[model samples]
Target: MSEQTTYEFHVAAQGDVLEQYITARGRNTFIMGPIGSGKTYGSAMRVFDQMCEQAPNSFGVRKSRFVAVRNTYPDLKGTTIKDWCDLYHNEDCQLGKFNQDFPPTHYLDFDLEDGTRVKAELVFLALDRPDAVRKLRGLQVTGFWLNEVKELSKAIVDMCDGRHGRYPSAAEGGPSWHGMIGDTNAPDDDHWYYELAEESHPEGWLFLRQPGGVIEVTVGKGEHAVTKWIANPNAENLANLPDGYYINQVQGKADDWIKINLANQYGTVATGQPIYKGQWNDVLHINNNKLLPIKSHGDLLIGFDFGRTPAAIIGHLTPLGKLRVLREYVSENMGVRSFMDFLVPELKREFPAYSKADMQAFCDPSGWGKSGNDENSPIEIINMEYGITAYATTSNKPENRWEAVRFFLTKKIDNQCAFEMSADCKTLRKGFNGGYQLRRIQVAGDARYTSVADKNKYSHPHDALQYLAQGAQGEVDYERTEQLRQTSEQTAAADSLTGY
Candidate 1:
């Protein structure tokens, strides 16, 4: 409908304000909508149409340059690039692979037919490398299309805008440079992209928000701006998308529904909103991980995420309600007994304040708890050897646990938390380096998120995050946690009650 129709629609008029506002825009503007809702098609049509019109003076050889960016190469190749190549490249207009054929791994370039060619440089970046987006230097970028702006951060937007300054604007008579587009639907309020950009540009920015089939364009968040909001045509303007794209994007996915699908924001569709979208940014630093000593705010607590390979760990707690994290102990092929022994001494050395009395320890209840098949748990053995009282905490409800971690993540604990880099935990860290990304589901469902799952065959990290969150909520009973059975036995008078 709207998608295919836009291709044939002819507006011979030059620089329609709407088209020009879209074409000449040099600032970061998000074009977010449901999966198919003409997002890919709308962007492609506007860019190609106006660009061809501008290339009248070009030589017989078509040459144009644009950057089609995504979180990774496959996303670019399989989605954005493919869409562009299939939709725009016609016979008279050739799509050629010059000497440089950037494998669709992340992003690539293409030479079009008109004297003007289109160069598509795909960049797969994570938020942790805020500077990574800055690397688009030197390349003469005629236009940039960030396919999934929802997964990107404000830092990246800033970098793209900042770097283009080198290109002289029309005022200087040298080819004046302008940005082609910025687009994403709605993301969580806590999302950095929303916080740093949306909050700041409420009225001054061009915002297109869709509550359902209807799309509204707001000049800014100001009262005057809100009055000027316009609804985009849903029939021919947005009809060509597969019927179920919107349904799959905002409702059925296992994650955020209202903001992403209905409101057209970009973010994880987590119903529980488990890890902060920023966790993506944090995990990106996994490659050059350097342990930053945590500043002690509260009694630091550690949670074990046991794996058959390198066992993962997270140590954090509010000693006196002040947040603090010791080091993260991650290792591979280490036995339970050795881990307990090794970690105890290591914890003692790092957090000297956690003396024999003030310590609280928690591990997954599913495996090796005292009542389980395994006789000695890592916690129990650690206590027997170090004389440090360790608490065996049962996990909190799954949804509740994810919420607890979110509370901490949303709070201001400037000096409280710290992440240390370890050779083994690099994979986990990489998972956190990027912001959570939401994709359009083919089934017409709500949003689904892609992030680091368990490195092990059994994706237990999801479970471990639940375990770690239990302690964060301060629900642990230091003494009575694992002692539930022992206390019950001591109090039970089975011999007398049984009429023996």
Candidate 2:
């Protein structure tokens, strides 16, 4: 044999499952686990191995193609592509220049130790929009790898499935393998991936869930209490990691973070600091019991927040003084007229028992100003055109509105939360959990937060809720109060003139 260098493959104790994952053929295979569990490395190595296994032509060049997908182009550059390049960039492999044409592709040409040449093309795709699905329509590929499947939707997954097993053509020999491999951290329990892995379990699908490394145990009492993380039986890939890796990682992490990322459990874990913190509990605040249906009872309270993305929360004060958010409406890239059109019909269909007269609308105080081409204010439009009397909140100060919401959440009504939201109101639920959160700043080795909550997709729904709280809590009518004060001063002045 010509002077040759050999590389030996050593399997970690936790890598047995990955070996099994590579051998098992399925229409869809998901390798889900916690951080540093070798999920991405193992998956990428397996795909490379499979591509090398393809039969070579007369020239001894094995040809194959693959599509690696991510949620956005920026993520493709920073994450998936970077990881892939790190894995395959070696002396044996030659990475070709990137093809910047429609549906960009990167070429990898390498030789196995056996002198077999491997020619593989990887197409990096990002499904950032609904139209992005159309880009996958006419592609030919042996297989696909979806990195961080939680960021992707079901429609993108379904579309990718249809594009596999078409490469190398029948003339050069049919594709040796055809399927999809996905890897992700534990996502929300309601995510589509969780539904498929835990609930659906469709035929020809392989779902592998790794056990979490950290287990939290409560110790002591109240403020003096301590929480400890004990190594659990589910800790995999420890042999591949540095000593005390998981231990160091779990320090200063929230309970949800420990559970979702370290424990590898399916639950709603906020990526950032939760706005409501101790006030909102998924089990307590969001459940079948809390998301109860409501019929038209007393006067319906509709809180409206207007903007590029307008939102409305329809609620009613229960007999026990609790505010029950029965339904909600949100729209994007819509005008006031279009939103009203959608909202009016939806209200009619859902709350047929209640009419315009029975509804009292409370809007953002800023809606009092004229916006865009509208000659009248948003409140005026609702009252004049929609025939529903709408009033602006007493104050637009975020602090006051947020305090009202906090009061409502903490208060108990018959041993339950005074404020209850329907599960169907997903946007509002996300906001209360953490999507609407204060901005964190690091100062002198300590973390500090701004008083104002960050304005984002969650802000609109939360603003609607805030307006509702301000309305329900009976804020002082600032406009009317100011008017009365002015009138009183004018009358006193007139009386003084008469006395003079």
Candidate 3:
């Protein structure tokens, strides 16, 4: 805001790539290009642009916050925002401010020799608290850029966007849009993004992929004019970082080494490795005609994974543990109102058939489900507000719940249960067959395990499974239910206290 800050990002063959991106960045609602195509660099520069505009806006100092989230902490650190800072502080950009307090949490906002102030600050966060996303609900954020979003659950994305906006101090907050960028290579055959790239209308989200990176561009205006670009930050903007850098970052990780680090595709090429030492034909249902019959009457536990991308599923269970996937619905790119238009009716139709006083749908009842990549909350807000009893499997510990899914599937594999693969449950099957990936394990005592998703990749189906499994046990502690109620009420009260 002090003076015009002149800068450009240098790329070898691309040649002054930042110049074009910096110019057209925010002017267009959304933009996408190949890897090394300058998407992140472009977006970061846009951060600078917003900061420039904010510095002079009389907010004391522009409290510009940039949110960069990934599936886990390491990915958030090693991949997404980490690389963005590299490009932003490159000698060419004339580094203003960086995360000076904690280098890992680099806050880059400094003035160049030209006296231009950098107002943008970053809030580096990871999806550690699945329920924490709702904290953003009813609030507004300046600029939110989700790096590798294919792996982010739809629920959280919506939470961020739902609360997305720039609340410049002293400015009446209406609808402030942020520059949302998504970067990813590609997802598996069953992933949600594969579907998003092809959608058109109030019906779906759009994604475009060029050689190195795939950009997920979300478009709209005011409260929702946010587009995301999903692409590879390494091969694209960081291509000139010398080969050693990638080897160090992604070396041993198979998914990283290939899907992103080396090969650009987010899918797994048949390495011919048998993750499950059994044949798929063995699990084929003999009753696989039109309308897969629900093998009824044995403690029907339903798992409802709420998501938009690949599709959320309603899995019906038999005591044998063999699940009959009853229903599957994908959100495409539509928002909550649209998603619920399909989900509520589906639940109504599906619930009655499986309804027992004890019947329940297990879900990630943490955040508001609004994005294609979000995990669906178990209890629907509309239903709840209307006094509808939406049976949900909410939990204090989600990791335990997710672990249960793996445990149940392993049991199925051991022939300890009857969970068989249905045609409609392709995402689940893919996940069980290794669609999802587990990150490198740190020394046990030192660090915790980190799991990552590849878009609608493996998690969607597994999420469905988790939701179903939640219903298996009727272990509802009325106390816990009360706690959840109290928590929600308390959150609401807190929002009120802050005048949110």
Identify the leading candidate in terms of lDDT.
Answer: 2
> Which candidate, 2 or 3, has the higher TM-score?
2
**What is every candidate's alpha-carbon RMSD to the true fold?**
16.0, 12.8, 20.6
Report lDDT (Cα) of residue 447, candidate 3.
38
Looking at candidate 1, the ten consecutive residues that score lowest on lDDT are 1-10
Q: lDDT tens digits, residues 119-227, model 2?
A: 8888889986657767777678899999888889888888888788888898888787788998888888668986676545677888887766766544553345455
Q: Which ten residues in a row have the lowest lDDT in candidate 3?
A: 274-283
Order of candidates by lDDT, top first?
A: 2, 3, 1
Candidate 3 per-residue lDDT, tens place, 1-500, comes to: 45555554343333234444444434122333433455555555555565555543433344566666666777766756657667666556645555534224445555534444545556666764569665455434566666656677667666665554555544633223355555554555445554344222122233434344322233553235353333345344554455444334443455323443333444544333212212121123212222343535553444544434434565555645555555556555654456656665665675655433334445555533444553433354433442233445656264556545534443543444444444444445445444544443546574343443334455565565665665554433334445556776788899999999
Candidate order by decreasing TM-score: 2, 1, 3
The regions of model 2 sitting more than 4 angstroms off are: 1-14, 91-104, 113-115, 218-227, 269-500
lDDT of each: 0.45, 0.75, 0.48
TM-score of model 3 (CA atoms): 0.38
After TM-score superposition, the amount by which residue 451's alpha carbon in candidate 3 deviates from its true location, in angstroms, is: 37
Question: Tens-digit lDDT track for model 1 on 272-390?
Answer: 22333422223122223333335454445556565453243545554434323334555567776666667777767865766656555555654345534766655655555455544
